[model samples]
Target: MGQNLANHLVPSQDYDLICENLAQTKEGADILRLKGGIPLANLETVTPQLKRLKIGAVLNGKELAAIGKILRSTSEIRRFFKEITTPEVPLPTLNQLLIRLESLPELTKVLNLSLEDDGYVRDEASPLLRSLRRQISGTEDEIRQRLVSFTKGSQAKYLTNAVVTMRDDRYVIPVKTEYKKHFGGMVHDQSASGATVFVEPKAIVELNNRLRQQQAKEHEEILRVLRELSQEVAPYTEEIDQNMRILGQLDFVNAKARYAADLKATQPELSAENDIYLRQVWHPLLDAKKAVKNDLAIGKDYKAIVITGPNTGGKTITLKTLGLIQLMGQSGLFIPAGEHSRIGVFTEIFADIGDEQSIEQSLSTFSSHMVNIVEILKHVDDKSLVLFDELGAGTDPQEGAALAISILDAVGAKGSYVVATTHYPELKAYGFERPETINASMEFDVETLQPTYRLLLGIPGRSNALEISLRLGLDTMVVEAARQLTSQSSQDLNEMIADLVEKRHTAEEEAISLNKYLTEAEKLHNDLRKAYNNFVSQRDSLLNQAKAKANEIVENTRKQTADVISDLHKMQQSAGNGVKENELIDAKTRLNKLEQPIHLQKNKVLQRAKAKKIFKEGDEVLVKSYGQRGTLMKKAGNHVWEVQIGILKMKLDEADLEKIAEEKPQKTVNRASVKRSRSVRTSASLDLRGKRYEEAMNEVDRYIDEAIMAGFPSVTIIHGKGTGALRKGITEYLQSNRVVKHFEYAPPNAGGNGATIVSFK
Candidate 1:
């Protein structure tokens, strides 16, 4: 089925849709951990049987069994897909197909109970069939006993061989031809040589007749059973046929997916424009272990690529790879290319690949190629992909090069994308001379005298004939002589190409080094940012704790003072003249002085220090040690100042601080203000319980971003175990998230399957 699907091309209008569906099916298979469903090996086409039933033809037991097997498999498949195709892990395209599959419980159950695996009707199928078989068994046993007795009797000598067998559904014994009349009641058969005759003994003739009658009755009962099963299937002929068709379609889709997985292929991004970009793509037919990968792109900035190089340098392979992958993409199959590879849908694909010489037609290689090129030019358009291998070859070099240029010109003018491979150096010049064409080549190693098979785009190929000869033990004098005979213009072009290749190699190496350094710098920046956030969090936590403790102490002192005053008033009331009101007021004034909050005195001291240019809280000071400005928090100890700078907190000696500016007025802390401050603080866990899938994902994304920014090593997402939609969605999201290093279900005590612990990179 996969081969059949691959052999044909899908229409361009439906191509992208088909590819998208196939990609979704592959994703569904991955999520389910089953390729498509149960092994389709047991699935057999039952369309013919269904057709027979539709025409009122009775289906045998085997045909019915085949149909039953399909029905059962369809049910299993429907159930399997339903297990994972929830709101969280939605597979819309595949789900549409699943929706059409109807389970036939009654029909399947009846077929399974009535027929055996090998298509024979079971005795349990009906009581009458069982009784008939039993009677037949009993008569057959009696007939065999009587025959054995005859074999052991006095007339046993007449038997040619003392064995009983059946001829024409009747029990018979082999007898010597001369004694046939002595032993037989009836001659059933005679041997080929006329030496023996098979005789039915007259002694058990009536028993044999009874056994035959019983056997006929059994046959009638079996047919009746088969007919009943067929009638049961007749009503479901349309449904059964539909089920088979759906299963075939699903199997075909799954086969493409399995092929993609096995090949480690990725879904290519289809584009509206006729631009191609294949990254690290190799020929699918080649041994991936040994095949060299190359990147090629065209049809965007340039409409054609003229690949010029010596024979066996993989120029042909490059052409074939591009052409084949294009077709594969259009056929709705994932291509054997790296991720992010982009392909365009072409209305037509023309290839003049390989040798096309014809003997019967008396056409030369050049004529054969010309015939193909002429045909290609007729229909080539902007949406067409044209490939010409060894174009204009087997002819004069100058004329062939000119013809190749003209053909490329014609094709490019038509706005068609063309890739042509040739050995003509003139075409290399043509690639440079033309505006919409680029030069490309396969790398050759002069030292190894072998092609590296690495494609270098934007650089023309060098023959390196002299260099190769020198490396292969040719004398230096002869090599130098050969090089001297070459035209200086040709030598200059090769030299320029060599220089460009070498420079490109050097640039690539430097780019790799720069990228490495850039990555290291980014890592360092992230580490510093995380450290700052952590410090800020701890600082704020400690500050809040200290403020709460201070507030508690002030409250306790206030309560004590109130209680003391009440005691004093009660004593005055009791003592009357013993304690005067004036004295009581004076004592209360002293107590009031002591009852003042500590912060009030500290504020007075701060005011007095400010008059003398002394640093205090609310003063912005620059720390000499870090050369960064910070707000003065408080005095930590003698001559030590605690300061807050961005996310960092530190204690520095007064001598290290320089007053930079005065701080602004502090705002009164309120409930809303505290809540706003706490909102930015990252926590070790987030609760998403009872949230919808989209809502949960939004929270997850925001939470993870904050977690990474705050430098949390890992955070738990509490989605809770309900329908598992949220959990599955979160897991999949994390898998594709660039920042998330890994994620897994939390431990049993920590929400178990209900939560995921996500660790960031």
Candidate 2:
């Protein structure tokens, strides 16, 4: 099926649509590769049954089963497409083919219930059929039982064998001819030996007759079921037929996709300007690993290319590669070419390839070729791609070269795209002289005496006849004699071509080296960009945290100050004349404690200083200037150490270095131990809304210590705004505490003033 579809060629006017289908095919192949594979192996074409159904013809069980299998495949394929399609890469073309497809589960269910896997109607297809079969089975069982009883009874002596058998669908027993009258039953059949005659006893004959009648009824029931099923299918004949066609088209597309993947081929782009460009294109039929790839382009810069080279140097292969690739593209199959290859749609493609000599017509090779060329000349126009191999070869060199040149000119005059291969040096010169024409060659390795099969555009191939002879150990005298006999103009032309080949080789090497460097540079640029973005993101996060902490501390301090002043005024009003000494002393003590937080705030640098610890080389330490951890390289000077952070190296004061310990795997803990230390693992917030003032203060103290140990940046204390007593108390405590860097209310959405958020130093 795949081969048949691949061999088909669509019309030129449908080239765009064909290309679209090829693109869709390639996409489907890629998805199938990722999604395990397509589940279309069991999908059989039911076109025949579908046609029968279209004409309202009754189909048998097998035919219906075939159509059922196709419906099952349709559902599977549709589900596959739906599952794999994504917004990022939707299969627009493939999904379009499924627009009319539906999951008619009821119809599918009915068919599946009625038929077996091989298309035979099941006994349970209908209640009447089931009942009829059951009756037929029971009657056969009764007949067999009656015959068995006879074999065991006194009448068994008349039987030649005690086995019961059937003759023409009725049960009977074999009896000796002499005892046949004793059996007293109808003779159904006689054995090969006349001594035995098969007959049914009178007693079971009635049972056999009843069984036969039941079987006949069973047959009628099966036929009636099949006819009903066919009628059920008739209503949907047009839809089912359309579905079969769509399924076949999808299968064809999938096959092409699979073949393309095997070839590692790419779909060709439609050239808007009749231009052809194929890079690293190889003959599709040739082994890709062994076949040398080449670039072939024409129609854009030049209307024609004249490839001249020695025989068996891949010149003919080049012509075929171009023509075959173009044809494959037109047929909606991917070509064996590199990505970005473009192909022009041609109204006609003419080829005069290989030997076409005719013994019957007595025509020479040249004449035969002329006949093909004449036909091409008459039909070719600006939209045709013409390929000729060994053009103008089977004749005198002088006449052949001139004739090849004239033919090329004639084709070019028509503006038709042409590619031809020849071995004539005159044609090489003619290529350079002609307008809209270029000369190309198949590369040859002179030392190895083998063709490299590399096509070199803008250069003519050299005939290394003398070089080959010398390499084969031909006498130097012969080679020198031949070289001396060569014309000076020919000698000059060969030398010029050799020099050009050498220059092109050097230039290609340089281009390859430059491309390698460019790739590395681009990769480095991307790495640097990513690293810069990460650095900026980390820096912003840390700065925001620090700013929030500072603002909270300032706001809490102001609130605490206002509360203390209010308390002092109330105390004075209650005392009237004077406050007690103890009470006055208590107030002074509270005021003195407040000074500690102020001192810490003033000496922030001292508060942030790390404990003294000896540092050594290879130890990880935090670089204060960069706020990043780095490996300690060495001591640069007294109280100075050099650190390596990422790719940067820096020397900083020892005071800036804070040694960081390497983390080790922790030992497994017991659940009981975790519960015992629950207070040590404090949460980010505490609730003090219902607690007494004294108890709440104590809880706040313990929670703050736990939060600090847990490395919490800030914690919320939920003290209801009611009575303003708890809020005022917590704020005053936070303000006087040296470790409390900040305290403030959370946002309105998060408990607002009822919650006090605290940050530790």
Candidate 3:
């Protein structure tokens, strides 16, 4: 179970990363060491194949000694010599290859080659190689001949019908004998009063000695090569190991991400805000194959949710889904959610789910639950997400409901978010009375007498057990008699139960219809938003083009006018000094004509006022240097006015303001206008909103400029305190700003510090 669970938790590809992170954690470190894969890169190369071999074989003394010798000799002899002789440092290409041979594919191939190939070539040049090869071959041939000769001699005798010799110990053979004389040539150990005899033949004994000598020599050679190779490759060993480790980590991370995505049933879009937001979320483990998807909304509005439903519903699954998703998210995996889903960082996640009762400890279900709850209560604060499956369910319903409500109230008061599942009716009623609590239920189909597995919000379910039993063919007379024996209040409760069932069913149908509508509406909304954005972008582009065209026309007109003036001045100079009075008048006339247009142009400039007092209270104005606009709320001075925009309040001079309208009465500040103005101002100071790449950069630039100009020691710009756009925008901007001394999110005390505080140089 552990291995299988590990397989799901850490993918083979991501094993390295999991191992590295595991190495960092106390538990992971222990597992990694126990697995004997340290510096996980090197360990990983061996683990896959190592898993296949017997543990005893891999860890045996002979094998270890052999491996050690190979590594030492290869680096010291082969690699060192190559490196010193080469122009550049020689890399152990072959050595690296050998190290990688520990992988399954390579090891399998090596074993196959060793077994299939005789590889008995005698080296003619080197006497040692030749002698070793000859000795090995000769011993093998002599052993074969002697075994055949012994068997033939034994068959001729009457002691046995046939004889066979088999290798047992290193130099010993078991010989089944038909003749007694052949056994005299070899030392024999009788088995069970000489029914079978073990023989130590001279040829076999000499073969063992030769084999040992050859093995030792081969071992020495391999060790020499391995040592040299290790040295040559030593530089890149760390890097390779690191890469392998990273690869392992990535594999596990990717798997976790994929699982989260699958569990979420949708892809979560990457964002900079760390706040988690989900709309209509369903529990992934709630028999999703058969269960109806529940719509759960969380994050922005209700940070904590209390779910109430009848017994045998899917409350536990809901808790598990939430807990699992959070775990997946923190491990740096993608979550399963809509593109708009935003998940935040949590310090810890505690769950009190499943039947935790322990008979050995003399604890009842309630006591067990209480113990777990107490542990959770002690550790949880804001920034932690708590899940309780069937909180306070095993004790008396009245007291249990009270305990549950109190626990929820306490957690909520601490500002920590929680989600708990319960079946207590009073607890469900409590949801209505409490402002922070919301009611939800797992639906049951009355007609079919089965759980629909659909979750409905804003409503609670009553146990439909009696109704279901009746529907399932229980005797009507028995049911009627039982109903008669019940109290009037109980009958009335049953009637109410019937009504709620009808309402719940209706709600379930309506919810399905609504979800279909919502899906369609969401798609349409997305399309419309895209089109609107495209139109705005195109309009901006066209506007820029028009401005460029207008500038070109104005420049052309100015150049033409200058040329005409120059020509007129030249003509006036060329006129002779002794000309007739009429000619002199004509020359003066031409001069006057040329100068007239110049005077007209100068008058046009003078027609406009040098300064216009267009500023008014409640008027929206654009600051020239600043990219944002604000509304004028009060007059501060002859040239200074106070503006209230979005979350920003500032004072600006009239010279820096331009009225949005040329000729209009001051309009009342509508909510939308105020919102737009606020959005504009917020945009200027690193809008930590849902901004992306280039858009964020622009905001950062504006923020730095504003911070520097305002001479603020430190000023905070609100970014919604999410994990997405705002935070990313601020960090990226801070990276390059020359004037920024430092910037970070404000401390928790100041509005929970969802804003970024920047100090300028």
Candidate 4:
């Protein structure tokens, strides 16, 4: 079933996320890990070519191992060449001398001696030296050419043997031995093996020998560097492994998301929530360009919505939309809907949207649907979403309606949500009678004699077939005759249906008008609130200024009165010869004049009271630290109020709380903030050792943001020594950050070049 779905389905964003998440699990890790494998360090060298091939999946661990082994061998050859080179000779200079020797007309002349007279015999000398001397003399050129061809051919064969591409789950790599022309390569021990090919010509063997000697010397230096690098990286090997695993998982997830999108034939909004909801959703398979948008709300109201409409309406399309969206949602992809739409989690989405007739089972269309329903019944639960399109259409009206009702009842009993489209009038009436059932219909235009494709809730449509047929050129007389032969009750029913249609239209228009009025009212309310807040703020500021001025005047008066009293006491003391009562009285009057009474007017007190009236208890409010939603429990003694919020109790003043309506929910904390908190608590930030220069730089940017938000004054980013790519990336991110104060590579005891210590401003 999985394979079948994969084949038929198109990739979607949700699928990609699923695949990636799945790849992160134990199973995915197992797929990438192999025994007796070449180290991943070697594999890094071949990643560029692998990326060029666009190969994303771990086809087999062995294949990756093989590639790693080849790279390791190449590394060894490079080391060997470096080791043989002379220490005194500069690599470039030595390479230049070798090139000149090869360009000479004769090696014997270039060497300033004949090979025959030299202590070295042709065969006794190094094969590389013999080839180089012969080639320099322009002798044995043909032999050198043949050797080059052989080496090139062998190398090509070896690579071909190592790599294979799969098509339709079968490996395709054409391999052959020199003896077999048609049989491809003879499989030995179930694995293809081939000889190593050296493309360099044998006539240039002498040049190769000299080069090898120079390389040997260089190899020792390279080995030393490698040893140091390995030690630097050893501490971070685990971290690098983790990153590779994560990248692999992401690759898988991306692929799945793409596939799901294609299968649903729609783009779904991506979210990381547990529920799915969509409003005004359309069927992807339907010609949305021509199809109407139908508003469907699932997950909260009636589990089973029975849609009843006239023939050729949009009942089936609605069913398909519901099913497709569920499939897309479960796959972790987004669906097309209004921004406010949400989806709920469902374990399974069982759909019977189209005919499932099977001749082999001797089942008619009705029987086929029944069979499918039976299958659904066995597995149906609260976590399952079921959709039945045109249920009971192929069977007798009375029996089918009864059957459909029973099926819906059973499904509801199982606690599963079901949406079934039907044409049975009995079923429609049943929907009206049931509390959990809702009746919906597609609107048809009587004047135009066409389906409007608009779905109406709480209504059932009448079959306007005969009337439409007549309008479409059928004889009016025939339609009239047919109507006459119908029972009186039936005729009354048709008239009642017409009356209901008119009322529905009127109701719809009134609903639209009401919405418009509500919108305008809301806008007015907001404007008034803003104006009131501004008025209150200005009033408070003005009152504060007035109070300050009053205090200043009072202080000045007190100072003047104190100075006058001191002068009065001095005068009394000086007039000790004969101090009259009238003179003392005059001194007191002067003091009284200096100290004028300070009293606030009644209007000032009223203004203060008015300013204090803006805040009240029991109001839903927003606090800075609590984000956008907190409840004001009660006002404390003076201005403080105690509030309860999400396991936190805070005592805040009126100035700290901003009133917010209860209707709107608060925005969630940012994901980066959450990750930062976790990192701080766990002390596990990203380790960029062994990563590419670009990757390390990206990690550095992410880490800095996280560290700052986590309240870390400083952090250590480990960037192991390997060409300094990781170090460079860390330094670059640090330099660009406004928050970063400075950074430096750690000292040897701390981590050396293998880590960087970043200080945050």
Q: By descending TM-score, how would the candidates be arranged?
A: 2, 1, 3, 4
Q: Model 1 residue 671 lDDT?
A: 15
Candidate 3 lDDT tens digits, 253-275: 33343344345444333222334
> Model 4, stretches more than 4 Å misplaced?
1-206, 215-231, 241-278, 285-290, 298-301, 310-312, 327-333, 345-347, 359-367, 393-398, 444-452, 485-761
Q: Which candidate would rank higher by lDDT, 1 or 3?
A: 1
Runs in model 2 with CA error above 4 Å? 1-13, 87-89, 148-165, 173-184, 191-197, 444-454, 472-474, 484-761
Candidate 4 on 1-761: residue-level lDDT in tens? 12333455443335444433332221222222321111123223233324423432321223333332333333433343355445542334223222321111222131122113221223222345444444444533443443334335444453334433322222233233342332232232222354322122333445445544544544444334333323433333333333333333233433444443343333333334323445567766655466577666555446667888877787877777777776655454445554444455566778887787888989899988888888999999887788888887698888888988888899989988888888888887777677667777888897797788887765666687777888888889999888888668755654665577457546645764687799999999999999999999999999999899789978887888788678777766766444333334345545545443434355787668555546667676765432435667787868788875533345777655667644545576321112123221225345876667776676676556445545577888887887875666667767866667888888899888788888877
* Model 2 weakest lDDT span, ten residues long: 669-678
Candidate 4 versus truth, CA RMSD in Å, comes to 30.0
lDDT per residue, candidate 2, 1-761, as tens digits?
33345456464446667667777777767765776445675556566776777687888888888878777777888888888889876878878888988667788888889998688888779988888888888888888888998788797898889999999899999988998877676998887879999988888878988988888888888888888888888777777777776777777777877788889888777885778878788999988898888877787778888898888899888888888888788777888987767888888889999998999999899999999999999998988889999889999998998899889888988889999999888888877788888788988898999999999887877788889999999999999999999888866765676677557546655654687789999999999999999989988998898789778866876777777678888877776555443344345545544432223444657556533346889887765433456788889999998777543455778766678875664695211110112222236789988889999998887676545534567889998888998788888888877768888889999999999888866
Candidate 3's C-alpha lDDT?
0.55
What TM-score, over all chains together, does every model reach? Answer: 0.62, 0.66, 0.44, 0.40
RMSD values, in order shown:
21.2, 14.2, 29.5, 30.0
lDDT of 1 at 231: 89
Worst 10 residues of 1 by lDDT: 669-678
**Candidate 4 local Cα displacement, residue 38, angstroms:** 34
Which 10 residues in a row give candidate 4 its minimum summed lDDT?
A: 671-680
lDDT of each: 0.78, 0.78, 0.55, 0.56
Q: How close is candidate 4 to the true structure, as a TM-score?
A: 0.40
